[model samples]
Target chain A: MASQAAIGFTRGAPSLDIIDTEGLVEATRLAFAEDPAGTTAYGTAVGYAPLRKWIAEQHGVPVEQVLVTNGSMQADAFLFEQLVSPGDAVIVEAPTYDRTLLNLRQRGAEVHPIALHEDGIDVDAVQALLESGVRPKLAHIIPNFQNPAGYTLSAPKRARLLALASQYGFTLFEDDPYFSIRFEGEQLPTMLSQDTSGSVVYASSFSKTVCPGIRVGYLVGPAEVIAGIAKIATTTYISPNMVSQSIVNQFCRSGRLDKSIDTVRAALRQRKDALVAALERELPKAEYTAPQGGYFMWVRLPGVSIDALADAAAEHGVAFVKGADFLLEGGDDSVRLAYSGLSAEEIDEGVTRLAAAVRSLDA
Target chain B: MASQAAIGFTRGAPSLDIIDTEGLVEATRLAFAEDPAGTTAYGTAVGYAPLRKWIAEQHGVPVEQVLVTNGSMQADAFLFEQLVSPGDAVIVEAPTYDRTLLNLRQRGAEVHPIALHEDGIDVDAVQALLESGVRPKLAHIIPNFQNPAGYTLSAPKRARLLALASQYGFTLFEDDPYFSIRFEGEQLPTMLSQDTSGSVVYASSFSKTVCPGIRVGYLVGPAEVIAGIAKIATTTYISPNMVSQSIVNQFCRSGRLDKSIDTVRAALRQRKDALVAALERELPKAEYTAPQGGYFMWVRLPGVSIDALADAAAEHGVAFVKGADFLLEGGDDSVRLAYSGLSAEEIDEGVTRLAAAVRSLDA
Candidate 1:
């Protein structure tokens, strides 16, 4: 049972070398030592209280406005389940996170995929849609280091989208799990921070920073909205796995989390550098955004209709998600490569294999 | 914000005293020491491989037939999502878990409430319903130590239910979370273990034995069906949290889990005895089946319409769920008291307060 060896760039997960295993184990020790009762019992649907409080403090929200979850994906699902009904109009970026699109479609929503430009989604297009009787109940956006596209939503676009949401009487679901992994660009204020009309429900995860194994994430919204979702959560999993969240709480409280984030940013920055350099060296004709931070970089080779790129690349011991996987339609020539889960050397090798596959397609 | 102190019998969670905290922490140390990568990475939807393998071995099934989840409620929800659609008929016990009814109703299922006898569900009623052309997509049953009722389905009833499912072409979802927590009666075989036909999807949780905070549960079925739910899980939360499950794996591997289960069984048996003795002493007119094992005792006071029982009990610093909360109709004379989350002393004190509240209602 020998498994095939491959350079995996398909999943946006952190490389093992970068994870602070000692710190997490230490945090677990601290969780049991300090809050054994909270960790070993079904605490509440609101999640580990200290973790929820910490998240609320980070977002400048009241404690009642925050609800920690199993992961940001679960947070997204809960929000969708709370707000979306079958046939309800919902807006998403054309090349959003594949799983997000999958969840929305599974819920039978009328998903209207709008174009995502370098500066973020075409905000004017959203305004136009809103004006033309496309009464979406929610607009989903990944504000910073957006998945698949690896483009941050510009501040102006963020404000414009928020304004449009307030104007159109629709909620803005801000899915920003990659908010803190930025290696370049100053941190932008969250839409939730700026919302005066209670239109934003923001979500983020500790997966990219702490580690994927922990699976702790949270949402910050209006008190009423959070409470309603908490009720749904009570019936869903009877409160999420609190043992991890309690450890996460201890991790955050111990000042190790900030250090871990710094460690991740520095390591991923090197990986990103190696990835872009290799892409330029190998595929000079390739098109991609120069991602400043986060795990992924989008690549498309111009004048190349290589619909079989993912398969061909896989044959060469390289793995990546095809761009079409993230779209309602279109993206056949594109692919998203996650660099976070690879060493700088591995990224170089993976991209070389990817370039070779592209050449084979051209042949 | 002065929160009222209450003796909680409302949640069927294990008391902190019974949980093997030292064993769990030791297991966590072992998890980090032995399989850091497995615990820290984004594991497959099948869950931590060794744990999955362990579960498969225990059930005498292939690893391909199992998919672990955040909890059994999640497993239930996934199965419901996969099988039941709006207006599809689903048969459940009349006094089932409240959250089960909540989830089914939310999915818009035309739920049929079957009568639950001391032995189990009335199979003849199900046959009559089937004769009347109610084509149920699924029949949900808790074969051993059921929630709220704490009654184990007899072997004959289990066999008959399996036969009925095979004949009617409906899936028998064996939700036996408390299968191992028994302190009395011989261990009966699971319906899944007995089924020759492909008609049972079984789920169980480690929450009862290990601790609720760990939140690891699983489903076992035919390979194709488990594969389908695994895909839904991939879209749902990427993967189940591997941290606790990995520790749970270590606990199992090290043979600590059996010892811990024994500890839990011994402690809960004492609590159960204390609860029953107090009930008989305080409420002589109370009607209750003497529970053999597990957490709850369903009590129906004859000629007593204390519909405000839960509120009155809460006023006296004792808490329990009203029986009507679990049923679609007619549980005005009943309540479910979970003794697992209380000490023997607390159970005695709580029952005393509950009897006082009942007397107030009678006055």
Candidate 2:
């Protein structure tokens, strides 16, 4: 099933063009000069400290609160492993990140979906679920331009969501991998930045801004939760790749991270704009959310079956994630079109093909 | 405790010196060109196909049986998480890798320790443990020159160990990170290579041979086990870093992997000899096992507490892992010193310090 997904899409990843091999060589050289033996050996489970400290400082959280991981995905997995056990109820946003939903479901969590609106996941729906005795172990939200959906949680809802979380007694998993990828909209305060009850377990990643070739991300929560995750980390990867972590730390510390982020932000915004505009011109009838940040656009094709659209689109020289793939298969009518890793011409071409596919589905 | 460990080891990695940054750059560049989007974006859970294929080909396993992971540590953790639930019976060799032991114990497993002999784990003792009503869920072993103990499981004993596992209905976790690092000894067939029962969940790494800084490793096992681990990997890091995985795959495919292994083997053997000779000259009273392969030497100080020795050595600007750290705390009088990371002069000076520390403990 996953292999088929790979065969389908023409992905756009700017980081590929941006990965500084010269920098890695320089870092590797510096790293070897300092500790040749330690490089090949195991590292700390909490991640490289300087990197952790940098992340904490970046987020305005205490250093102890930040924990490094292989990627934000790993961080999410750690949160689930530490908090959500088998048979536990998880409150997830519908049309959410497919992988996050899959992780929770695979772990045997009784996943209950809270509908996502244009702004983000509905607070009232979550409240209703909480009141109806779902007793969700966690509420996983990608408040900042959520994957695929590209829907940032509104500021008004953020406070209410926190309140609901406090009242409901379920931890909130704020996965904001694309937090810094904002191109057009005002940045909302993070759910974690406002969280007061210690009910938020936050995850972020450098895959978007820096480089994904190394797979370095982080998890932040209470110390106990972080400790549990650390135990998991120890058992799992021993410590994350210290070499990559150290390189990233150096990259960020040396001010290269800021420049890289600027590069990614401008490129992504241009790519996102081109894709959105192309889709509008080519298929205005197809309903899709206009994204402020991030790489994906959740498209709802009214009167067109997503599976059929996906099949047709692929046949027409364009490929995208069928909405049903994001849902429990055979459960939803949404299709996720990721424009994050495409060139302007490719995006236009892909959307044009998608438009043709959509029209064919209606016919 | 973990913080202290991370702090004490502040030097650069040795394997980084061996890494061909130019080759790596070329590989990364090629990989990015092919899957520019895949390398930066979220990828399949099982791992990148090229890397997985290479790993499968290397292990002589089917492609379906291989999983590329962040590192072997993650593979170990994933297997433990999937196979050993809380209070699950796990059989481990006493004086095993401390991190692996910690991984299982922290997961609430009833860890049954089998004594280690020079040849391998005491199969008779393991059989006795198996017979004594502890139905073991898993038997984890380092079949090559293992951590701390640095003892290879003998060929005859390997069959006996597998037989015991079969008789007892337990899975064998064959960790062989050091398998290809052999210098002086004859290369033994791995448990996975010889297994007919489809039982061994094998793990290995490029850290020892290429450079651990990149943190690329793999796990090979039955399809069901690999599937289960894949679910965990999906949640953990979604997938391994595609760039790293692809680069390593390319490097391996180019046939440099064998040459790289040979380089590491020669370097480690030289360091091991230097350490051994230093021990002979400086601390003749300390009974030490000369490792035939891999990076560690197990030194036992009779009538002197290894903890005291470690502390005294630390004071004198040298450090070694106390045996107690490897086993459950409050272990036997042994210390594990790794020579792979340090220079020959450092090894000699460190051992000389260790000798003085032993004298100080006696005094």
Candidate 3:
């Protein structure tokens, strides 16, 4: 069973070795030891106060503009619930996060997909859609390193997206979990930072940076929007997990978060480099982006069907996500490979196996 | 500010002294020490595996039928998201949990509130609603120690309610957060325990039984329903808090939960006794149920508006939730007093102050 098991390139999980498990455990222990009762009692629906304030300060926002959530996904869910009425127009990038697409579809939004380029989503296409007289209630974008796409939205596009949101009267829902994971390239200004019209609702998660098991995230937006989301949160989860929040709060306050992120960034850079080199050596015909950071790389194999490639790759003991899963329309020749959880050696082996699978398909 | 503060009878929080804080801290510590990586990594959207298995074992259900949630409220949100469409009929107890009512309202559920009596909800009224051709998508009930009412659904009513659900082709959403909190009377069989038709979606929380800050809860239902809820959970929060679930799993497996429950029951029973005796002495005119267990006592003050009484009580150094907050139609002369958070002495003082408030309103 072990011999036949696939080398996984489909998981977005952070490498376990990179996680500061000792620090997390110590923080949790301290949280329980210091104030067990307070830590274990019901917290406000918005989140634990100190954590919310901390996040607010980090984002240079007022506390009223910030709300802590179970995770960034919960933040997305709450904002979707608050903004997307049935049949409302919602804009999404073509190759966006699949779960976000599912959420928008479930919310009954008429999702308009804008083409995602190497630099970012096509702002001109979005502008065209807006000019077509579709009044979108929200536009969900990952301005930093996008999931599945691994492309950062250019600074110019970020500015334009903010302007479009203002002109079209839609909320720019910026999901930026990988904003701090950059290993190269200059950091782009966030859509939230660029927006003067209070149209950007920014969300980020500790899942990628700290620990997903803690389930902590924060949303920053206008006070009224935050309050509305908090109300939804009250009826949804009552409160975010205070025990985990307290632990995270301690981890942040102790300045361990910076060190943890540094370790993660360094490790991820190594893995990303290994995957890119392996791809070049093994799959010469494959077209792919070298992501500066984040978990995924969008790969296009010329003359190869993504479905067949994925199936054959699995049989050859390597696995990846079919790119069609990320797109609403078409991606028959594409796949998404995640290298964040794999070691450099494992990535090399996985790419070699994937190349063998591709050759076998041709044979 | 401390001197002028009112005695608080308004909190739904469990007493801090009663929680086995040391045990909780130890469990958390053990969880971290045993498997920090597994405990702090991404888990399945359904929940942490061992915790789901444990809950399944406790409920005598299959693991597939159990999905751990952020809290019981999140379970409700998932189910509501799955089952209720806009304008769908939903049966709720007249004086149900305010959050449930708010969630239903937000979902655009045509909420039909049936009267809640001393022995739980008016089952006959529910039957009448069904018989009157109102086909509700779900009937939500708190079978044991119903929130704000301090009533248990009789065994016969539970059976009848199940039958009604089957007859009406609606799910019976049995929310039993306080199931294990019984301090007196014989324990009633759960609606889920008696269910054979697979129409009951049972939800319960460790927040009340273990600790709220941990934010762990679960749902048991048909595999298909659980799968659907898990799908929603995927888009909602991605997964339940594994750190908390791991700790709760440790707490349960270590044979500490039973002892903790015993401690809580004893403390709550004492506080209930104090509140009951004080009400009898200080405000004999007010009618209230002496709850067998749970945190709340429902009081109906004769010839007094609850809002006015709540205002008067606050000014006279006491506080409680006005009954109107818990109802759909009317609770003008009622209020909900929670005794779980207060000490026995505080309960007596709070009641005495409440009596003074009542007199002041009359004066």
The candidate maximizing DockQ is: 1
Error of 2 at B94 (Å): 2.1
Which structure is stronger by DockQ: 2 or 3? 3
> Which segments of candidate 1 are over 4 A away from where they belong?
A1-4, B1-5
* Candidate number with the higher lDDT (2 or 3): 3
Docking class of 3: medium
Local lDDT at B264 for model 1:
89
Q: Write the per-residue lDDT of candidate 3 for residues B1-363, one digit (tens) a residue.
A: 226768887878897788887787788788878877779898989899999999999999989999998888888888998999999999999899998999999889999999999988998888888888999999999988788889889988998998888877899999999989899999999989988899999999998778899899899999999999898788777788998999999999998999999989999899999998999999999898798989999989989877788778778888898889998878989989999899999899889988988888878
Q: Local error of candidate 2 at B240, Å?
A: 0.5
Q: What are the candidates' individual DockQ scores?
A: 0.80, 0.42, 0.73
What DockQ class does candidate 2 belong to? acceptable
Q: Candidate 1: DockQ?
A: 0.80
lDDT of 3 at B315: 81
Q: After superposition, how far is residue A362 of candidate 1 from its true place, in Å?
A: 4.4
lDDT assessment of candidate 3: 0.89
Superposition error at A153 for model 3 (Å) = 1.9
- For model 1, what is the error of residue B45's alpha carbon versus the real structure, in angstroms, after optimal superposition? 2.2
